[model samples]
Target: MRRSGQNRFPEVDALRGCAVVMMLLYHMLFDLVFFGNLKMNLFSPFWRGYVLSGASLFVGLAGLSLTLSFSRERKHRNVVPFSKYLKRGLLLLFYGMVITLVTYLALPESYVRFGVLHCIGTSVILAYPFIPRPWLSLLGGLGSIVAGYFLSLKIFPFSFLLFLGLKPPRFSTLDYFPLFPWFGVVLLGIFAGNFLYPGGERGFTLPNIPAFPFRGLAFLGRHSLTIYLFHQPVILGLLFLLGLIRFPL
Candidate 1:
């Protein structure tokens, strides 16, 4: 997944590839249900675990990538600039907003209010200030995890803070990844990246593996954002052509 002219960590891209594969499988199952080709509860423990684990992997990898990028920039320039991160985060947020509009138009009853893209973008922006302070970032991450856990146990009257993991009464969403616990995961990744990678270079050498199959996976991982943006529509379109685009509505 290393760009031709940029610094990259191959292992990170491979891990991202793994996460994306899992995500694709999960979404395929979801589409099967949407098209009445499956009759299983997606909220079942197996599905829930699968989804959460994949999300965690992706978020953690994102944090790791941030640290690497920051380190590379800092090496060339004495100070790390915030503009690049801000631009990328806002761009992702815009894409998330597009998803929201599309879902609202297509499936208003269960549209995405705040999904993975929103969480990642928001987390990147919010976590930027803490990246330079690994210890503080660790504490913040732990705190968010604990706070979100307890918060999830209680319900609120309003839904405004749903992005923060505050559950509102009778609320439902197609996808939700609140900042509380999930951002904490990102922080933890930052902590790990700082501790392990130190200056963004691996502390230890890794054996060079053949790039035949792994490179193929890395390609998918590198373009994951673009793939995510279009995969659902592609899946649905294929299903529609196969006479499987059934919906209760």
Candidate 2:
């Protein structure tokens, strides 16, 4: 659409933006429940699917983009390219730590352990080589969900595997993606991306955009990384400063 090298897929970016938007909404809702202002039991097994779904969408897109990043028609690698991915991953790890620090400072008893960003970030680095393979990625991604589901129903030293989205247990982290299942989703995306866009001048067909809104979604998509890292903090700050927090401290 915008020349080969500068070939930006509006659809993918839009999807990432959408994921970020959903993430904010989900996290915000959780905050409400955590503060006890909301009536819903956000963590009930019946409703937990909603949280996992948002995570699935986000990771699926990450897989999809892995393919886009290597389009042959495209030039100009990312600013730091692979390193940037690594850096983003580490940044998330650090952010997770910082969250623990803040929570420990505030609500020490229920601090966040392994949130989505940490899972996503860890996957980014681990997902590199796998991006080149499709079948493997699919198996791994779907495997995560299956594993987590089954693992959650049991209890044993082996049960902790599910929290990693592999084996399963009753124990829950503040936000857990577990390397097993989430990585599988990412792998599935990689597989899709590879099958769709296998590099070179003539790779991957772009579908026709039929009347979908574009510019705004594209901007959100482009800035999704920044949005993910900051949206909640900004919103939480706003709530705190505005005295809208009703957690009944």
Candidate 3:
């Protein structure tokens, strides 16, 4: 039931590309504030909503992409191996650990302990059972979201559980996306993926839109992981070169 000779979905990639643009803009503003050039409040209502929306787009897309991958694999093998997900998840987690190390060295006070990469990696592993069950995924996703709300209300003393949405009092991070709500978002994406792209085929009609306009965005989306890994450094370097920020000698 796959699309004829088309392995990738341009629409999905374009949407992900849009999210990447949003992320870049948000991080640029955040870096400005970090460098003392801006006094804006990112925790304010507008910025908070913006951040949440951008994160949702990324996480949800990851979930949807998982379903497509699973279906595609199923076509080739009788039993999809858990090792496939395991390896992928571990690779992402490894990348996340690298970020953790870099940020800890650079900004120990508010370093990322378990950011979006960690969350996505863990979600990919945990979501294996839920991919084929849309109804269960829906319930699980909503439950996780509700549970996250409750978890955020209380602060625990244990720092080890930070990845699971438990926070110590006064905990701060430049980036953080624990499993509860964010993983729930992934599950919801999985649910939507199953419903919208059952057996890796589009369930709805899409217009024959021109590819030229979307080519750039699609390219960005395809290389999003690399962009995410490098964007901050590039942005900071640009700011430094522009004389907007000076190195502390």
> Which candidate number has the best TM-score?
3
Question: Model 3: residues >4 Å from true position, as ranges?
Answer: 1-6, 208-213
lDDT of each: 0.85, 0.67, 0.90
Residues 1-249 of candidate 2 have per-residue lDDT tens digits of 433126666667777777777778777777766653667776688557866676777888877776666553245653325675688679878876777677667766555566666677788888866665677777777777687667556566654344375433345445566676677787888877777666623265656664456556667888887786677678777776776666454
For residues 1-249, write the lDDT of model 3, one tens digit per residue: 123236888778877898899999999888888784888898899999998898899899999999999999989998888888889999999999999999999989999899999999999999999988899999999999999999999999889999989999899998899998899999999999998989988889887767665777778888899999999999999988887776665
Candidate 1 lDDT over 1-249, as tens digits, reads 344225876777777888988988888778988676788899999888989899999998888788888888889998888888898899989999999999999889889999999999988888888887889889999999898899889999988899999988887788888998989999988888887788877776767668876787677788889888998988877877888767565
RMSD each, Å: 2.0, 4.3, 2.1
Tell me the TM-score of each prediction against the true structure. Answer: 0.93, 0.75, 0.95
Choose the strongest candidate by lDDT: 3
After superposing candidate 1 on the true structure, give the runs of residues whose Cα lies further than 4 Å from its correct spot.
1-5, 208-212, 247-249
lDDT of 1: 0.85
Candidates sorted by TM-score, best first: 3, 1, 2
